[model samples]
Target: MDKMEIVEKHKLLSEKIADADMVLVGVGEEFNEDFSDIGRFPHLMSALEEVDIDQMLEWTVPFLEHRFLIEHNDGRLVEAYRNLYEMVRNKNYFVITTCIDENIKKAAFDTERLVEPCGNHEMLQCSDKCCDELYPSGEFSDLVKQAILDGVGLDSLEIPKCPVCGKPLAYNNILCEQNYVEEGYQRQWKKYTKWLQLTLNKKICILELGVELNLPNIIRWPFEKVAFYNQKASFFRINASSYQMTEELSDKGISIGMNAVDYLREYQHL
Candidate 1:
């Protein structure tokens, strides 16, 4: 797209996104990798090579694994996580993140995943019974489906079957791990999905922040489709590479090759 066209579409996108009833935010590790103090921890990586979920679930693991990454003068890791969490929690937004580490999940939920040191403090309580009251998040479900699509076996996915009923296990609707079984959590997640679906059919703007083609199509495809269908539904994508939009979507979608944080500042007039 031309510079003039890009700027015009960006203005439209800003207006639409600002007025959107619901915005689906997909949390990614790119921002963390760029901003995290830790490059890599050799010892922690070696320790995690054992592939023991139980051992990894120890209370000390999250702190130890993320110790290097979280080191920053302004507590950047924690603050960024909290800021993103609060943004989604306060706005009509739903977050979809990959399960790369326990610390990321904890930061996303603002709650501990391990039950060893702080058993009762875990966000989701367990029933220890076989109940069909659990649901999984679209993000989590899409991850599993994508893994399988990428040639991962069901067993290799690290999901365990139901212990009591011997049935297939599902991530409590968020598709994190097999052990993610919480009815309450699933209920809330479903609400987000339902809201997103409803909003997609309406005229809305999508702020595709820092998302790239390397990411999954779960969010991108739908956003593109919406922009294509509705002339008023503008789209904005901020990346390092020069932004490009589909020929059909170019009129409504804006592609900006710039940092997302910088764009956000400008967009918000901060």
Candidate 2:
């Protein structure tokens, strides 16, 4: 699309955002740029395929922790997240994301207003399920940072141990075969469920940002259902590449093939 078309879509989206009583933000990996190269699933698996399954498991856990904690910094919080914070700060809104990054939190979004089903990198859990407890990752993150400062690699750092069971601790992110602690996720899900029921007939807008069809069953399809069933609701898609809505939502949906950050930043001034 041309510049004018992009601007027009933003205007229309802004209008819908302003008119809605509540905004439901569905986010994906595209929201953060720092780990864009690391990739997900098959791509990540290909990179680690050389290592045996057992060795890969040993390397993958801490590798992910270092990626989010050591490599990523607050500087990566782009203008789009900031502008989005401004747009929804005073307004009634909730965010649902599949990413484990802390970009949204760093941007000043309320913790109580977010639901992260995929977990986060700032926490850790016992590997043996010794207890249903999660430990803060600040100390571990600091250790990793210190190791990097000393020009040492992740392998040089000692793996953290669970204080209760004395076993190795693992990052609290959801893994393919590993069981994950879901207390925090369940709490957030309860809050989201309550809000969803309360706003069933209200004027709601689903702002799908950088979310593709990767895991449509989780947030994408559900958000589409709500927008489709609610006569007064609308779905606005902001993606830099593929931007589309189903036929049922063609009339109520607005698709803009523009960078999410750029669109939100432009909408901030408008």
Candidate 3:
């Protein structure tokens, strides 16, 4: 869009925030700029494809390492969250994201006001989720690094097994949803629910960035429901393609078709 149009949208969003008692931001899959993709890690994908059996960690261990190795201090993900924080910093706001990366924390967002229910890459849990415990994910990453330095294949190393069930260990994310443990983010979920309750009948601003159908129940559907029910709420949806608001909410929210990252970056810079 043109500069004047961009400025107009920014002005509208600012007005909504300014008039609200509570502000909520929902970040979805697009926020995960570092997430593994064939375009970004073709070798990893090829490795997984060549394996006969489930050689997931062959891909996963390296995946975690790749995510951790990135210096977020100057990365786009950190910059996006930082730009977003500046707009909502002064408002009574809470941020929720499906991304498991630690960039939000790196952006210095208030821990008490942010939640990531999809799980984090830095933590591990039993593949079967035999217990509520989550282990540090660094152990497997270290093993992968050592093997790389030793010029040996990962097959030569023993993957960490779950202590409770003797099953394989996995990242604490939805990929292991067969029996994913929720303890890591359950408390924060409760806090988020309580915060939502407080928004009822109050002036609120809801901004959803790059959200999609990946977990509609958690964000998309609920956000639309809240916006429709709360007459005092103003909503904005930004995405490259899936920015359409529900017909019921079209009058109440603004849906802009654009890349969320680009929009945030430009919005901040301009």
Candidate 4:
């Protein structure tokens, strides 16, 4: 959708949801991969061991997991999470995050006590020809400050060492990898589940933005059901290509085809 339309939609949605007591906003993964403003980084190709690069593209988790690992290790994940947390907290919105590593979420919350499980060995192992650029970790400022105290130039400063093992560090933000492990991730996930279940019955508007039906079961099916029984509820799916509303959903839901950010911006102006 164009900017104007998006803003208008968001304003309407926000107003519509204002009285609903609780609004469950499910943040999708990497909404637009091609958007450079979002930034791209190296991802570990775990499937390279068993399948070709062409075949690996069919599997979403491995590719995304790799990118998440790189982004988290570099501190981008922390910044994004902080931004999201602040936004939600300011609005007094009871936010729940799904499909994100628990430890990464914790680090984002704690801020000062950031830690990564894998050392540089994992990074070197995952580095491939296609993956060259490093995700900018916002933590670089702190590293630079430390380097200045030691009287070193930016170019001569070494990469930050891992606090856990005192070894060289790499981004440990990959999600859904077989080897991708995080402490306390499950605990946060359980909390999210509890919150979702507890908030299910109230009047809600399922604002499904840029989501596709064929993508993953975690998003599609549950949302479909949520929009089913909630009599005062509505489901709005905004997408460029896949735009359709079931007979039942159409009776109570509103589906649009457009860019989500543009819609939100338009609504803000309205």
Candidate RMSDs in order: 11.4, 5.4, 3.7, 10.7
Model 1 misplaced stretches (Cα beyond 4 Å): 1-14, 32-36, 39-63, 66-91, 99-189, 261-270
Candidate 1 lDDT, 112-154, residue by residue in tens: 2111111111222123336644432334334434543564432
lDDT of each: 0.46, 0.73, 0.77, 0.45
- Model 3 regions more than 4 Å off: 1-3, 35-72, 139-157
The TM-scores, one per candidate, come to 0.49, 0.80, 0.83, 0.51
Q: Which candidate achieves the best TM-score against the true structure?
A: 3
Q: After superposition, how far is residue 2 of candidate 4 from its true place, in Å?
A: 9.0
Tens-digit lDDT track of model 2 for 103-139: 6776788889999888877678887767779888878
Question: Mind giving the per-residue lDDT tens digits that candidate 4 earns over 95-131?
Answer: 3333334323533343222222221113321122123
Relative to the unseen true structure, what is the Cα RMSD of model 2?
A: 5.4
What's the residue-level lDDT of 247 in candidate 4? 73
Q: After aligning candidate 1 to the native by TM-score, how far in Å is the CA of 136 from where it should be?
A: 17
- Which window of ten consecutive residues has the lowest lDDT sum in model 2? 42-51
Query: Which of the two candidates, 3 or 4, achieves a greater lDDT against the reference?
Result: 3
Clashing residue pairs in all predictions, respectively, total 5, 0, 0, 18
Among residues 3 or more apart in sequence or in different chains, the pairs in candidate 2 whose N, CA or C atoms overlap within 3 Å are: none
Error of 4 at 36 (Å): 2.8
Best by lDDT: 3
